[model samples]
Target chain A: MARIDLVDLAHSYDGGNADPSSFALKPTSMTWRQGGAYALLGPSGCGKTTLLNIISGIVKPSRGKVLFDGRDVMALTTQQRNIAQVFQFPVIYDTMTVGENLAFPLKNRGVGRAEIDARVHEIAKLLDLVPQLDRKASRLTADAKQKISLGRGLVRADVAAVLFDEPLTVIDPALKWELRSKLKVLHRALDLTMIYVTHDQTEALTFADTVVVMHEGSVVQTGTPEELFLRPDHTFVGYFIGSPGMNVLPAEVEGRQARIAGHELSLARSYGGLPPGARIEVGIRPEFVSLAAAAPGLLAARIERIDDLGRSRFAHVRVGDLKIAARVPRGLSLGGNEAGLIFEPAHIHVYADQRRVEGAA
Target chain B: MEKIPNQKAWLLVLPVFAIVAFSAVIPLMTVVNYSVQDTFGNNKFFWNGVGWYQELLDPSTELGGRFFASLWRNLAFSGAVLAIQIPLGIIVALAMPREGWGVAFSLVVLALPLLIPWNVVGTIWQIFGRSDIGLMGWGLNRLGFDYNYVANPIDAWLTIIIMDVWHWSSLVALLCYAGLKSIPEAYYQAASIDGASRWAVFTAIQLPKMRHVLVIAILLRFMDSFMIYTEPFVVTGGGPGNSTTFLSIELVKLALGQFDLGKAAAMSIVYMLIIIIVCWVFFTVMTNAGADRKGAGGER
Candidate 1:
């Protein structure tokens, strides 16, 4: 168990010899505390997995240093780093028995045969794979293969951290729930520093204790799941962390209020840096939007379409020139008439150039 | 289902099956016809009626002496190739990159030898193994070992073996490379987090993951090696007194040079049967492995 610190690590795939624009990951610093379950969540090509690989010593930073337990590992190989990583697709050996696959690391390290057997038995039992020890790994279903992948990753007792890069993506849809919960149990039982990378919001939110929201090669925010959902530090985090995402609208700020779609919404807090007519926007989660028949509140919106999302209904609405989503409780009688969009004033967030400007008042 | 009959699907398989079957059927039928009868110079035929089979077992037939010797040589050659290629190919595959520029570069370089024709590889090596022009021969001759592919049996065998390694190790390498490539990067991540050593990653993750491809590689290499004629023949002409004469080269000598059509036919049938049996053994091992993993029936 070790704490990983990435210090001002900037990685450039473009050789970094030409220009400053060649950098993929600009100099960024962050820390993952020991035993913390962190997920690097971002869209594809956003450098979430790249950052994780860099942390794991698969990709070294072109500048700065990566520290594990306060020791610089800039010149270390992945083997020297001793990081366990699970890829998006299952990577278990097909030829070996499931038992052998699980016990591989122990065997490789020259653990006693009896001890290896016990550890393999324990892990297989924990993974509900006790009955499959004798079976070759290739014939197992995709889920079982993935479980072996996880089991192999967890076999070693002295690993620095366990890094999962979209490990659940290849699992059958029905088995994703069970395997994810198994990983959580293994994490708790072992208390290893685990960093999972995924673009799936629900998986990131549910599986990780702390979510590190990354966008375009930089960490936008890292906080507990609730903190991420409730108060995102950046516009990307706001849009990325929520299902249907947060609704963002162009706005003009004056005094204590922000005007959006030709109407004003009260700001909970004021920012001294943002200019009056600057490129400003107000953001709120779709889940917080209250539907109305025909009245004025924050602004008026036209219900374009209603999407039934089981527990809630997302009314695809048009707020002036912008299309925004307002999630109402399932079976709300929303009409095509100008429906007033109401949100708690304290929940409103104002952004200037993709950075948060208005604080909660 | 009637509305969308899978005609397009068959379009994909038709070309491959056609090419494979057409190439296999004619020569096989000729071998079969020759196996059942004896032919003379004027095309006079006599019914042999399993005489060659009795001779094959009796060890008294003129066919058995040179034939069995080459058969043993072929088996030994296949064993030696397997002992060297699989582990070496896998190591090369592991050292290569999973993606990016390194991937394409490694692939192109590794694929170079596999693209050369069998005869060309033999010719290239034959020249390269010469004491005069080839560095290997020059170096060997410089050391006064008296290495010559044309005269010495051991040297011919060694040259053929080296030439075989050079020509075909790449196929195994490329196959294993493809296998290694197909492994999801997730496995490496899993291995890394497990605190597995690099060796553990290769043995547990890389080797196990490459089983199917390695099996295919082995089978293809085995069958190809078993049927090997062109390379060894071009290099040693099955000479240096039969040191490098494999089963196929012997079959060719019998059928083409000596005109022993009936014996050649019988041997070809026996050769085909041996190939079939070896292929079956590999198939059995692979299928059983696959079945044991599945936790159910072996049926596809």
Candidate 2:
């Protein structure tokens, strides 16, 4: 079992920057438990890759403490860190035989030749690369090359954690899904700590036990996939973790009612002490929103457009000047002019500034 | 759906092929004609079948042994240049920073020597090695030794080797530098995460990755050195007898100095054949190495 603790970590490509604007990753702290498949999920330039690189020792953080199993690894080189990283593009030696590339890391660690062969074949078999073991990497297809790269990382069982940095970006869609599932299964069987960095919510949700949602250069939210989807603490996580994203509309809140386009929605009876004049935002997952004919419901919105994505439907509704998207089940024709929208009080997340406020008072 | 027939594209390239053939084939035919004929002054000619080839291969002939010796020196010179240049090039490339002002700075400095023309490089070395006026020669002489390249064969050889190293070593370094630069930063990252030592990074990753460029650098240096003439000819004039008279210098001595075009043309063909054979061996070695990496990936 391996546990990693990162403390006060920040990085800037430029030597010294007193301001956060000059830094790529803001100062942050985190602890990852052993055998947990955690993912750093964010868009490009969100510092997920930078954080992964820092953890792997490829990138040295400007100010930080990186501890693997309670031992500080910040000053240690990448080799000393004892991590395995797979990059966006496959990086196997093109001249080396597949078997050779897989065997190399083992031999470098001074593993016996017989043991190296045994481990290489075992990992190759797991990755479905046994048939191509003798072929040159240059002659292999893109998918095969990436498998060799994956095998190289997996061949060594002693590493603290396996870090993946968008390793499936170059692979085809079918292979991508298969490979993602394979990683999940392998993590379960081996019980190794895995940190996968990806911008795709589906991959993060499926492959990671804990999804750390990052935006700009800061960690916005970190929880299980269900926790993130059902209760996003930050507006960025709300928008980033779901398809059709959660619809965030401006509102005026006073006491128990939140007014939107002159239509006020009552908060739960429990919330009674929200501070006044705070910039209030109402967030509701598209899947939770339902259209009703009644007027005393949550809010009033005009149906702007409807997008059909096979099994589910997305209705873009206009609430005053703001647009909110609601995910509707199949076989429902959303009318244009005036439609009542309702959400369970539990799913209606209220926010002050960008941070989530407690159940609306 | 009706099938679309494939059209011939070579018809579009016919004129380019004709022009290339007209220019190259005619000149090669002239050389081949000269290689098999005996011609004295006044354009007098007699049929000489395999005459020059036989004389050059014959050990008893004076000029024959000279041809073999010159060829040997040419081969040895190419080997020496490869042994020194390729590894030196890789070292310089590795030491060069990946990006920023340093890379730009190193690039400009490396480019400076390559910009000098071959003959101009020879002229500069020739002047720089003069005993009376040149810095290196005068400095060496002042240390109490005869260091005259014009008279001494050993001095001339050293000068030529140094001149070649200075003039062309930059090219090998630059090619290797490009190869090294093209390697993705991720490979180093992977090696680092693998806990690969510095020597392992160089041996397993850097050196193997530079194999393609290394082969190219060797081929370029070999071909160029095997046909080297201008620099050594301009610097030492193949002087102090035939010590520095490589195949190209000897060819010139036969065709221009003695006006024996028949013998010179025959030697030129033999020289071309040697280069082709050596280049073939190099290609074979590289292809086998590439082939050995088979089955590492999927269906090729």
Candidate 3:
């Protein structure tokens, strides 16, 4: 296993002359620890694939070096880098049997026949594919074929890392869960550094120990799933992660309090001398905010709708012209549209220019 | 939903039925009619049931001897053409540029030979093979070879075989190119990441993916070369003492050249049956080979 490092790596499909905003991936440096499960999460065309390709040595970056285990590998081809990639669709050799497909990488590297057989058997057993080892890979279902793809990547013992490019896209929905958990189990058992690229939040959050969220050609945040949910470093992260997302409202902030639609709210920390004329806002998760009957001590809002999501209920409320979502406590009933929103002071984060701003305590 | 058996749906096929009758049935019926009857100068046809067939099948007779010789010649010609064209076509397809303006440029150039009329191709090669004037023939003769297609049977055969390969391999190449194009970019990326060698990728990925197109290429080249007449007829005219005469040329010489309708009709019927049976067998074998892997182990 190797720790992959990107030193100021970036890519522009139009070559280096393109504007910064047009780049497929922006200049950034990060390090992936050895044997860590990392996910590059982003929407389509958000440069997650571009970053993965750079790591796998498939696409050379316009700037910066890629270091593997403290060695510069910028000039290496994908094969020379010795990384394994599982594609979004299963790419099995149609003419080969399952055992042969699993043994392909080993055979390509000129491993001993006995060793190849042993590795293939080990991977097949781990993947529960032993029964179909002799069957033609082309005749299997998509999920089974994807399992073979995974097995091929894992069969090689000396791979630097295994990269997955949304490998479960073609699988049946019911099988995605099984294959996902299987991947987690494989990671723990094999102790391989794996990078999973996907746009699905649940897939990234559940599969990766560290999730890197990218938006519009750059990384917005990189942290643990709980860290991302609890404290988003960028406004985009706060908006992209949570269900119904963290509610963001245009507000005015002073030393110890904030004003949203002319109502004052207390802050746990002090914000002194905020940047002149910055577009300031407040962000808080729905789980940290709740609704109560209109009271003098709370910020007044009109409840627009209530969503009952089996486990909990969330109230979509409007304070003046700004829409906000807050939790509806169990057994709490509202007789009319009027209600008040209670925000947890510690969970309220401030933003200026879409980047999170820390306040002085 | 309840199923309804509609008889009127059969009437909806009337146009197709009429079209097939006019295009295929009526003309084939004429050949069958002539095969069974003997016709004289006054258009007087006498019943001559299977006499022509018996004479044609019996090798002791002139017609049978001629038929067998031309049949063997046709088979050999087809076999050589396929053996040469399929591999050559695949190589050419692989060499083709994958992107940018070069793709369109190469495709158009490759299709030029296929666009030429068969007779034109024959005439071009016929003149192009003349020892005294043509560039190829003069060049070979200068290189100290007596390369005259007119007098030498071997030279005549070589010229026709080379000419056919030049004119038809592009069709196979184009089909293979299309098959290669349909493979996703991900497959190549995955292969590279797996550290596959170039030849291994060709054998394990390219060849298997090109199987369907190769089948088409083989069948087309086989039938087209087996029934070949125009190009070789124009170039050789079945010359050098009938050494290069194929089945089609011989059949045409029998019916139109010597006015032997009954024997020609019998040969034509047999020829049609041969083409049908061969193509049917070929298609079945190809499809079966592809699907055999699924035997009792179909999709989960």
Candidate 4:
């Protein structure tokens, strides 16, 4: 295993650099530390799979250099790179038994019989495929076949890295969690650097040490799960990473003071030298907002709707044509249409042009 | 209390029954009738009982020996065609263009031979194999080989086999192409990631997935080759000491040339029975193989 560095990588399916719309992946650079579980997370058509394919040597980037342990591998084929990848759909040799399927990579590499057998058996045991080792892969259930797909990758010890492209998509819902936990355990036990590509936020957050969130062919943010939740680098990350995402409202900023919907508010940080002509906004998660009984230092608003989520309630309120959501604790006795909505200074974040304003949290 | 059953469902099957009886059963009954009875001049009938069948089945009798010889010939021809065509078809299918306008162009080119009528195919090869003016015959003669299909039995057999291969191999290739197209791209991607060679990919992914289509192609080629008469009859007329006389040609000769209706009818029935039984056996074996693989219940 080795650390992977992507140097100014960009890809265009049409092979043209003039039209940005044709670019599948925008130019960007990042590093994945060795033995670290990193997730490339995004919605569909967000370049996550493109990034994974470029790293796996399946698709050469239009212009970039991929360095594995600082050695450029752009010209190497997938076989030459020796990376193992599991696809969205399980791919196993239908004619081969589970044991043979797991031993395929090693056999291709011309490993000895005894060593291949040992590695196959070890991986089979780890994947809970010991009982079905003698059975043909075509006869197995979808989840079991997926396990074999994973096992084949794990059986080869000389692989540079293991890549997963939505490998759990075909798995049953109840079995998804079980398989995900098993993947986590395998990553830990094998100490292999793995890059998992998925669109599901829960899967990315739960599986990766660092989650790279992409939007519109560009990397929007890359941070730990806690860091992403607490401080999003971009507005897309703030909205994409959380359910009932952070509420953004247009605001005017002057030094340590901000004005929103004709209500003056005190800022926790100053944006003294703001960029000219940049749009200013205030962002706050619903969990940090609270309803109050008409008090100073709070904005007056009309409650539009309340969704009771058993443990907590989401109160969607309107303040001067702007809708803001507030998560209220249970038994708060919120009944009236008119109430005061308070934004916690510590949790409120200021953004200029969709990017987080430095020192303006 | 017993409920009244809906009797209307029976009427829905009436049209199918009528069609089957009219098209198949009636013609088959006429053949069966002819098999058990003898006819003299002006339709004067005599009770033949099992005499014709017994004579045709006994190897000591001339009729029986001819029937068995032609039967063996038919089987060998079918076996050779299947053995050669199936693999050749798969290779052609693999080599066909996969996508874009080239795919359409290749498909049209590949389908050209299959679209030719069987009789026309025979006629084309018949002239094409002439030593004087035909390309293949003149080419072979020029290469210092005395290749005369009309006068030589071995040459006739070779010509017929090659003619049949050219006429039907495209059907098998098209079926295999359809099978290949049905496979998802993920399988190929995974195979590449697994470091599988081209041969391994074919054996593991392409071959296994093409099993159902291959079975269909085998059955079709077997049946067509076994009953083959028109092409070979038009080309060689079962010449050169009856070496190329297959079962259908021999049956036609017995009924039409020699006016042995009873014996021809019996042979026809036997041929039909053999084809049915062999096809049934093939279908059963293939379907059972499919079930056995999936029946192991690897889920648990």
Per-residue CA lDDT of model 1 for B146-174, tens digit only, reads 98878888888888877878878878888
If both were scored by lDDT, which would come out higher, candidate 1 or candidate 3?
Answer: 3
Better of 1 and 3 by TM-score: 3
Model 3 TM-score (2 dp) = 0.97
- Candidates in order, TM-scores: namely 0.81, 0.91, 0.97, 0.96
Estimate, for each residue in A287-331, the C-alpha lDDT of model 4 and write its tens digit.
Answer: 888877666668998888888877778988999899999977666
Over 4 Å off, model 3: B1-11, B292-300
DockQ of each: 0.36, 0.44, 0.60, 0.60
Clashing pairs in 4: none
TM per candidate, chain B = 0.87, 0.92, 0.94, 0.95
Q: Which residues of candidate 4, in runs, are more than 4 Å off?
A: A294-297, B292-300
User: Residue B273 of model 4: what lDDT?
Assistant: 97
TM-score of chain A of each: 0.94, 0.95, 0.98, 0.96
State candidate 3's DockQ: 0.60
Q: Comparing to the true complex, what docking class would candidate 2 get?
A: acceptable
Worst 10 residues of 3 chain A by lDDT: A153-162
Native-referenced DockQ of model 4: 0.60
Q: List the candidate 2 regions with Cα displacement exceeding 4 Å.
A: A269-277, A293-300, A329-338, B1-23, B131-133, B144-151, B284-300
